[model samples]
Target: MIIRNLADRNKKGADTEVVDGQQRLTTIYEFTQGGFSINDELSKRIVRDNSDSYEFDIANNAGKETEAIKFYKKFKKGQKVSLTYGTLSSLMKADFDSYNMALTYISHHDDNVIAEYFRFVQNQERLRAGEIINSIPDSLLEQYLMQVDSKSLLFKLSWEDKRKEFDKLFYAAIGIFDEKLPLGGVDSDIIEYVKNSAGIAGRALERTNLLITQLQALSKDETWNFSSGINKRFVKFLCMLCGYGYVDFSKNPKEKLQQLFVVNKKLSAFSSAKATALSNEFVGYTEEQIENYRLIALISKGSQKWDMVEERMRLLAVLMNEVKI
Candidate 1:
């Protein structure tokens, strides 16, 4: 028997459907379940000597009282005839475990599996998160969104477009820093922000992209994968980048983005004691800056909560535009 797995099939929303050998398999299964009697054409001959045995009683031989009562009512009293195939021992003698079926499974994916294809393949027929985000119509924030090319070094870090990583990040950033709302954002929030956020989000993204581009160029880790939930090495930069609008950078942070590194190592890996101190003891930084770094560590612990997001972003924003090259 061959079975097909269909994803878009319309037959009662079934994920699987029969492809071949259904009639023969169904007949065999019925026979194994003591369903139908074998005609003389199927059997060699009738067992005439044991014709009176209950084993020859095909109608009620399935141990079904209802079928026996039905056959009794249909015929005259004690006139039911018992018939069995030649040398057939009994009626109920089937072992379900003795049968094993060989399956030849077929599906639409059989044709889709490119066994000898290239090193990489982008299936355009299936839309990815990046594609879905791009497909969104003109929105206020989308119009001001950063344009990261597919061929860019940053794009290469993610390799294949992860499902909704960028969408979540973009919406979360806008909702936190730009909207200044306590609620987290989703893809639809892109349009909502424009409808509601006066002009804050539009300006936030426009300015944030510039700083993002700067950090991308100055970062030492080539594969600084910043996508949500995985290798979020630079999320703090986003949380703090918007704060640059309220602060002055003429102070020329006594810190440095050594070897083209951008965010301070202490901020990147927080609260990890010596394991995270990037430039040795937050050295050369003033007491106010040191407090901000430690304060960020405390706030980041609860940053996933909506009420804490704005505060976290506000604190982290002070940390940006201070990476002295």
Candidate 2:
């Protein structure tokens, strides 16, 4: 369907008209613009005859003159146009109403999806004590705002561009920490631990600030190198290990992150040691072994019970170690 509106170029008054039927005006407009083809002769006749019948000739022709001329030449064999033209003003009001109705129908159908997206965007803001919180601290309820903001690292990390790598780091950190400390209850310490480790509060912010400084120290290419690919994995792993995992450096806050690099070195060593073992056991192994490796990796260092985590880790370690032989 198509509708065409005729309007005066000067914004003097309501000099607008609907040159064609409101239901079909858009379709006719599209057809005129070559977006669609009018295959039916009767529809073509209606379009050609309606313009002259209404005497509708305002500017913004919508290709009507050229289209009408083409249709007449092709179909009517150059017959004189026989439609009446109407005032552009009345046609415009009908066109506006029809367009609004179409939009209303579409919005009704998409209301749920629109609402969900809106909620997701709103949730990005931190909340505190039944109030929406802004990004800045110390506005009204500072302490509660800070607490909520600290806990929101998980959400932020989930949406990171390098999400999968962050997920692996998070799972691994939680796995290691849970094995050692065993989160028994939701206490202030647990909350503080999560906030501190995730770099959402206190020492975490300092650490992040330092990391950013170091990044700024490097050249653009070097900075890009650190941010890309497996480097991101390394960085996230370092953060997780230092923040939550089991690695005891001295009480010096500055050295805590250094300890994480040491743990990553250990993990690298472990991975290297297992690389040969993984090759031999899967000598004629199909892709299924590789698939199993990924599944096994998930449970290898997660919040599983000690026995389950150890078993999975042992199995993966063995598989990886025997791959070469």
Candidate 3:
């Protein structure tokens, strides 16, 4: 439920909006409407209470009711209840670290979309507030945001798993390319550089769009059955390439697509045993090997084997000149 502070209202209306828990509110409304299976506790609680002599006032501080309190009163089913309240405007201005940590924790328990939603809000807020601390320019970031909001064809590509693979694609692209931005300079100067550095962003977008197209076609081909792990590793590797400045900014998309196809075909043959052997070879390099294994561990869940993702990652490390051999 949304509440508007009378003092804070403009000609259009309320200044506050609920940023989360929208679906829960819908479910509760439907339950109150007797549309879903409910226990006697819920049925008794949802009924309107006429005996109570309470009134809600938005403007007056003397008798004003909090939004949570007003919302909870309707469902006061004679049980202990607690509701947390947060304003959307305050959250938009929250410290970046706090917001990032919250999303990180939320990602562990909540669905992917929830975390993605926070990410979208955080980045959009940063752009709006002129927090260009990093290299990514406002214009480039806005373009990517537009793509996410629009749900263009590139984002519609499917994969073997149920995870938000398309979201991962965009995040990976931003993560990799953003690192290449010129930093440690004035914000205005950096923004100027980014605005003129269209070639870099263009190359990254070309690879990303081409990969999405290829994935879409491959998904439609009934005979092809690539594993989810391979697809993810492939995308991450592409980001590594773009992030590390390995891709020639002027190179045509066709050439990069051919290179990606070759790499994808090679990665198809990767196996867990090979990844294990690769890990064993770098046993003395504990930190490096552990990081490699960590990437593999991310996709190791479910019935499929994804430990081989480490091997592919190791290959990327070498290609990016992080490893001597």
Candidate 4:
């Protein structure tokens, strides 16, 4: 009954998009458009009142005050009266476009607020039961990355529009895989590893909230340091090394990083001895050195062409195999 009244109100120029009760609104719309007669007495009463008020407004808009009397007489005789309804399809399209544009503008203006708003909406009781379950993951991912320190080297190396790409790459490097990736023993291992490295497991879980914000900012051709650039391949390889439980060997982390410069120079020579040097160096490198090694790995894997990121990964895999042997 309420749905019918709302539909009638919509026909009379009232705004009714059903942000909260879309299913109900849709059913009402179908009934109204399909010319289903309302048997609910309460619904009939509301519709009648609303329709009468709307007809009066239409008559006034048409400047048919005098003709209204004639129409009322015809209406009494059961004549069908034509009332102008607003162009609903066009209005809906405009509303959708306006909403999307507003979201885009808001995200650009203040991503943190946008992320918070999405978080709030997703947690709403009414929303949790909806068919849009996948949207939650996306929203959480976005919120997580937006909170990452913008001053970080990772952010500095990433393109603004490719935050989502970077987020995905980071997650993959940390062994999160994709959405289909099972959250079993392997997932626990990966999560534990990240927590141990960052010294905060709870915070790491919370960071997944930023994924959506990053994806929303992506452009068709945009690239990120860890995904479509050299950094992507590097991080992946480094993560693999970390997965193997190699610890930094240097007393000072900074000095350990300097060792990577040495490794980089030797690797540039591409010799059997260089490979041996890499294994020896890997065993004793500091955590910071491991980080730099990851960067070098990315650089080694990257290409100027967008198509070459994957190729770089493939090439790095070959180099890693040879180095391991």
Candidate 5:
């Protein structure tokens, strides 16, 4: 049976509607009105049937009251049936068992997994906060805004993009320090610096916006698609590199963006042509390389990986050295 919105009868607004199976509904209604008659043998068999193998319940037999049987048939399938008495109260609640289950799962996962999950939760919080901030009045923002268009502008980070950033920071920190931290993603001083900040998520979004703005200002070339595939990943890596001081964004913004286009172009080709080779070659390299290689391997193996993030970041590190700042 299908349920639909009833026409606004009396202009009071509809509570519900039955979009299909009206004949069946009428038959059932008549059956209830007829007092649900059945043969005495069938009634005796139905009441006695208690086998678990049976699909339907036999307890609602011909002997049951018509009103009770009619009430019993109220619960139909689908969301339409459930909306008969919609409550505004919360339907879901977080409990200790869920927390414990998450904790248990995290305990078994590697540092990369932990870091990725942590960033995911943080990004969700950031998204909710961004929504609230965006809902606020522009006048209020103007009265209290400190940074340059920071409140007005916000960046969207997907789970994959955020994970890529986490991996980049993890590896870059390790490479810079030449020593592995206690936890690959979280124990780095660089990560700690960002973590201690008041607006860590906001800062990431702002920097990303800055990168996109600068890149767009450099050229209007539509040769590369920056919204999806490898091009977007390349842009994200450049943003991270600039954030980490690897790429001098201020020195030659135009030149850097041009380099990005070239590198992204090459990376795109390599991804399509030699994905497996790319994954294999990057093996036993830096943490960043290895992490990215794993992502490439996942892609090569036909797994639906997140947003070409690893491949793009890996290419950024590779091509950055060749491209003059």
Candidate 6:
């Protein structure tokens, strides 16, 4: 439920108007137009096309693919689409929940406005967070972050499908490096870095990719993927170390990397944890192992407690046995 207000955009530079979730909004809009049906039982309850009670003017226009026509088409497929009513009284008879669509309005006529908004929309899991930072104008660090997400082989291993999963990892890496992670994921401090961190974050990402490539070369499986929660955390750890010059990637670091993430570690999960149930469900995990997933409440709560995230990173470093960090 998002759109850009382009009322004032008679200008030449910023012409692209942002709109997200077209696929979802279209289906809902189509439903209001009586473009589909629900079930056989509900279909029977709807006003029959031939009935005098069918009141809309469009109902009088017979054969141009009406809702009733679509209904029969789906009924044959054993799948019901949704419904249509000829009168307000008929619509009132159906039981449904009331919902108010909340919209975020973006009306700036700058390129960053469009860019950041597009990023936000793409990351909306809620695609909202992924995008907000991308919107923060062209900073050297932001350009670097975007480059890392799209280009760096290390980040690519995770394959964030525009949800900005990689960016969150990147931010956490920055947070750990700076020791200033805020309540929300990114604050003005992070944004400033994204704008111009003097290419520090950029160097860290590049160095991490170097290590990842060397690690991949050591692997027997050509498809060896270093992407998982633990792996990603390790990656951020490596970046943190790289940023601080604490870890040396130059001297056969692959052995240490292998020690951190075993060569044959099966990163796949048994089930897609239903996030609603406070689940960290994964394959071969012990009860204590699953229970150790902390800071979950902050995941749902918008204001993240940075201490827990910092704690998690500390534990990963310990697991890596990187006393140097």
Best by TM-score: 6
Q: Which is the winner by lDDT between candidate 2 and candidate 6?
A: 6
Worst 10 residues of 4 by lDDT: 100-109
| lDDT per residue as tens, model 4, 12-78 | 5854332345565566556446434333444333323343332433544565443334433444455
Kindly list the per-residue Cα lDDT of model 5 for residues 210-320, writing each as its tens digit.
544533333343233233333334534554454334466555555665676555554333233222443444434574644443333233222122334334444555554
Each model's lDDT: 0.42, 0.34, 0.37, 0.35, 0.35, 0.43
The TM-score values for the models, in the order shown, are 0.34, 0.23, 0.26, 0.23, 0.26, 0.36
The model with the greatest lDDT is: 6
Give the alpha carbon lDDT tens digit for every residue of 241-315 in model 2. Answer: 233322222233224333333333333321222324334444476656544553453332323444554354344
Q: Runs in model 6 with CA error above 4 Å? A: 1-107, 110-136, 140-172, 183-290, 294-307, 319-325
What are the per-residue Cα lDDT tens digits for candidate 3 across 1-325? 2121233545678543344556765775564454565354543332223111122122223755655335445445465432222211111112111221111111112235444545665676634322212234345444443433223223322342323344444443443344442211222333344455444446556644544444344334344333323455455455444444445323443345345544444333222223243334444666554444333333322112222433444444443333331
Ranked candidates (lDDT, high to low): 6, 1, 3, 5, 4, 2
Which is superior by lDDT, 1 or 4?
A: 1
- Model 4: residue 256 alpha-carbon error in angstroms: 3.9
Off by over 4 Å in 5: 1-198, 201-230, 273-318
Q: Compared with the true structure, what per-residue lDDT tens digits does model 6 show for residues 1-325?
A: 5556565644675543437667877776766666764565655444243222222223445656554445445544666434554221221222111122444445444667667656655765444653453434364445435434243444434544533444555555555444445433433444445555555445445544443444333333333344554444345445444444434444555445554453112211211122222232334545454333322212212334545544544444343452222
Return whichever of 3 and 6 wins on lDDT: 6
Ten-residue region with minimum lDDT total, candidate 6: 263-272
Count of clashes, each model: 2, 42, 0, 17, 0, 13
**TM-score of structure candidate 2:** 0.23
TM-score of decoy 1: 0.34
